[model samples]
Target: MQAVRGVLAVFVLALVGIVSGGKMISDFPKLSVQQMCELMPADTSFLRPHTCNYWVRCPANNTSLEEGTCAAGLNYNKDLGRCTMAANVDCPYSKDSISTTDNLCANETDGTFLADNSSNDCKGYILCKARRENKSNCPNNLIFNPTTRSCVYTNQYRCPVNGAKTKSPACLSLPNNTRLANDEHCEKYYICVDDILYERECSDQSAYDVVLGRCVSALNATCYSTAKLPPPENTFCTSMGKPKVGYFADDESCSHYYICGDTVNGKHDTNPQHLQCGQGLYFDYEKLSCRERLNVRCTLDRCADTSLTYVNVLGDCQAYARCSGGATVGSGRCPADYYFDERSQGCTPVNHNYVACAA
Candidate 1:
């Protein structure tokens, strides 16, 4: 009866310790090799099986058990009663199950890793478990600028002029030299200068037209000028190249012609030289002299077949005809104070007073 009572008392103590989640022995003595190793069965998790590196019977006389921790890089299998390699210890879940060089959690199989929406914090790997992105967010109404590498508001940023807008909600650069018409005035226009739009008024009571690039009179506006013509070799010169002599009107008066001579000492003579046809007479190349502009008969010649020439009539140098392809197609004109001479086969000054047919 005494032995049974002692056994019953020991069992009752063990049962109480197990049920109350209390350690029966406050401090267990360290175990050495060749000693009994034991593990408390109640202390193990049901999901993850507990392992014991070394176990021992408390006091070396009781049946109650105690467990010791596993060694580094080793895990204990309670069923096998021996320490094993950690790689061989298979857990039910793969979370926190791997090691690596750049990141210890690189091989961790916690959750989905979103590479496109991830932050720089996980530089080499990811450990997010919620399936949402772990992105570093910018402040309210601000966007990340990759060039500046900072968050900036759209309104505060000064984008480049005439550049395409960026993807990160930044301000767009407007095109340079854009023009707009003013609503209040016909003569006034708007021009974008250096990305700033401002009103520009045309001088001299002219209406604005973008195609004409200037203002003109609403009724008597004449936007036509020889200045609008492009110069030779893309240069804005008075004259250049072969066929040494050419003519341009001196202003809107059409009373004088600016003789554009070829390169003399490597420079063009753009200034108009004085030449006059006396009153009651107009220059006529057909007669090769100053004759009346009206009732003038120009005799056609075979020399005109291969060359082009012009004789002035009705007061304009540009008003002329093509002398080519075996026929004089239409009436020709000369410069303001000059006329074509069939004898010379070129333009001559009327002030020379030399007649093609002289006595």
Candidate 2:
């Protein structure tokens, strides 16, 4: 009994030493592992929340359990179900489940995470600013990707931002039969139909409409410009496997263009410099510069045939569409003084300033 009392006295000294050090006992990170490891049922192995190096296994009928730490330079990946190199696994967080939503920020430092609410788990997220909760919802066509920490296309990320909300309350409350712009590549977009995501790419390099959520010319649509366009190899400025230095126009949008080389040194930059012209100016790809938007023309399937050079705009005499290599590039409308001679063509006065002819 005296030996036991001596051991207890040592423990009390250690406790006093820790308490006197000025940090609360609860402030130690291992306290969570200690508390949760003991509470888990025997014979179960589990990961400690928010940590990548520590894992705990409950021993049979034992009150105490020891946490196992991963070897040096390795992190635990729950998806791989094992510990591996940090490169092999993406350790966004060690555990998929978060604390109860009532206090989503509980035990969480100053950071943001998915709200993943039970009743409406589609697009909500909670931001932890100054350790205070600021809950907000993503737009109707988007869903929160906890991994990316951004609101993405509804079809790109299946709803239920976190795993806790998945299949728990039947399913997510995401919008059905909706269109969403791909946040990465301007050429790609998505459609969510009946809770399933369908990925799509534009036939041409058209940008997805930000507001209407449909394919529109880059000149017209506000494509999500987050640097995910086709690489330089596939872009218009690429030649002999290297990007050339110049201003390159987007295929569809008259207003948007990109600068492909260094401005200061004339050396080529790694990525094409995406840019936009003023509101009314369109990028003239052939002239390799921006010009006033005047005669760009378009109609349903008017420029489908590559063999045709000019197609008259139906019903409109002033507007015509210019097709080159089977795609409409600009408007072929005659100048105000010179009307399109239908013996020449009747232009619809749409999306074009003809590069082939003077304005």
Candidate 3:
């Protein structure tokens, strides 16, 4: 029917998140929306993979899809096609290579490599194993093939997004521990435990006070800045600085949570009033209400530039942190009889994979 629907065109990259004459871009142009609309085949829109601020149009012939947002503070810049602002919006879902703190496979003298088509995309491909750095792709939608290395079929491969040096996660579909604010590296921040989305930083490195979401003193962090904006429309409480009244959580859904009252003058209702959690139940930020669904696990958070991994410290048991690729670096304490132990990285009295920091 339209060539078997073109499978949503796979990942139609034209390349351009804005940078026109200065021309430095370095590949930047992603557009996955991964898999939504289930199967549209209508007027065709598709630009919601990782996120620019939400979208999924599709009308003309209509197969549904609808769901769009991009205005307050703005973002959605599919290369000037719309919304734009927040420096010019780069975010297409982050990670287009550039991680190297040494060890992206040392020098690779042993098996399946792939990233050098300037850097990435041929559907990813890193492997390695012992030295670490997994980063693989090309499963079915196929695209690897660095001269018969593997994966096939494609109008020359797709996936490539770097949202200005990574920092787009406020932990989608929030409601776990939920604490966020890394508008784009104001020293780093983001938690959501149980819902996932780790990526923290700023123990003394300072700067990330998006109105008390934590970390301070980069001259008092007005929201520091390494420049490269556009990853903040946070909207769960707008980065939640003045929020206090009662329950809060739900940036997209965890069955739902959010409710504030009073403080009409000091300003702290970053869009309040949200509820829902009783049909099979869900919301449970420390038993604030609703339950079940394995006691509410939710889900969201990502890391992969090579991702080493290890997290827990949002509420603290003794402490734990370490994530290498995608950043979080250093953090671990556990002394009194030992604690933090993911097998071997230090701190251990036995208790490995983390059970909410053991606290």
Candidate 4:
């Protein structure tokens, strides 16, 4: 009887072990909160613990198995496990947790971005188009400096005016019909019109009268030099007493006649007299009077030596007078069209026909 009972006990223990193993396998926990939190389902709506776990409670609300639980906490919905907020509502995922797209930019178009896909959203993630920061869009005749991020105009052609090939940022017209060239620098061709100075483009020389100071056809236009000369024919003459006779003077003698010192009229006369001429004048023995020598005071007719001319293009007179025929005038010659032919040494017009006398 003792052997039979021991054997029966062993058989009973083996059967109990089999039953316990089967039960443990069937009653195993379906899911844990830690596992549910980490699982990312294909459909966010299926993220509830009821769907994912066989035995665990809801992970989001910590509810029992009977009450559905959301995995996304307060952001979660019973039907949709994913977190979402109503339009214009503040949300944790947003920059300001708001349903607006204001803080984000959209990625579209070169060098451009969009803040929102739909106009309804005031704020969202912005998308931006990627571009090289160093790229530029400068055209010819314009240089772009990356460091400055500015386009600079250049004068590579060395033109006198309007030479810049690039279009001007601002169009500027010449004031008072001013002349200009095709160079970068606007060269001015100025003329006196109706007593008023006017400027024009240098290339439009034909459209202006340089002499009349008016706008006229450039064809056959008279080009004038800035030079001027004083009037002609005003003079003074004084005779140095007939060749000093014997280089002495006598009170009783009508005119003291000295030894022949100089020749006059091919005669060995004892009179050693010399003739004295005033400024702008030379003695004319035939007339026995001083006459104007145009070449004497006129810069145009004066000697070719540039230093002798009284005035230059800039209208400045030389500091000293010009010497001619071994005689020195007290003052320099007047500019072209002006004359100082008289003993007064004042400047006057060369001819009323060509130029009006200046006051």
Candidate 3, residues 243-334: lDDT per residue as tens digits?
A: 46778657466567887765666655555688877644557777787764333444422111223466445445457666776556677677
Q: For every candidate structure, what is the RMSD over all alpha carbons to the true structure, in angstroms?
A: 37.3, 22.9, 26.3, 43.4
Instruction: Give the range where candidate 2 is weakest over 10 consecutive residues by summed lDDT.
Output: 166-175
**Per-residue C-alpha lDDT of model 2 across residues 255-281, encoded as one tens digit per residue:** 677787643354345567788776545
lDDT against the true structure, per candidate, is 0.35, 0.50, 0.47, 0.29
Ranking by TM-score: 2, 3, 1, 4
Instruction: Name the regions of candidate 1 deviating beyond 4 angstroms.
Output: 1-178, 181-190, 193-195, 198-275, 279-354
Overlapping backbone residue pairs in candidate 2 total: 22
Ranking by lDDT: 2, 3, 1, 4
Better of 2 and 4 by TM-score: 2
Question: Could you tell me the TM-score of candidate 1?
Answer: 0.16
**Poorly placed runs, candidate 3 (over 4 Å):** 1-10, 13-22, 25-227, 230-359
Candidate 4, lDDT over the whole model: 0.29
Candidate 4: worst-modelled 10 consecutive residues by lDDT: 166-175
Kindly list the per-residue Cα lDDT of model 1 for residues 1-359, writing each as its tens digit: 77446544543343333221211111111113112122111222111111223332232333344546667887554334455787885432234322101122234454433221122211111223332212223434443343543344555344333343111100001123434333324465545344233446676445665334456665543222211211223222343453335544333222223455566776555443544344423345334354532333322332232343543323332334445563556765567777555434466665323332221
Per-residue alpha-carbon lDDT of candidate 4 for residues 254-296, written as tens digits (9 for 90 to 100): 1121223544554345334543445544333334454444322
Residue 168, candidate 2: C-alpha displacement in angstroms? 37
Show the lowest summed lDDT stretch of 10 residues, model 1. 165-174
Error of 1 at 179 (Å): 2.9
Model 4 misplaced regions, further than 4 Å = 1-267, 295-359
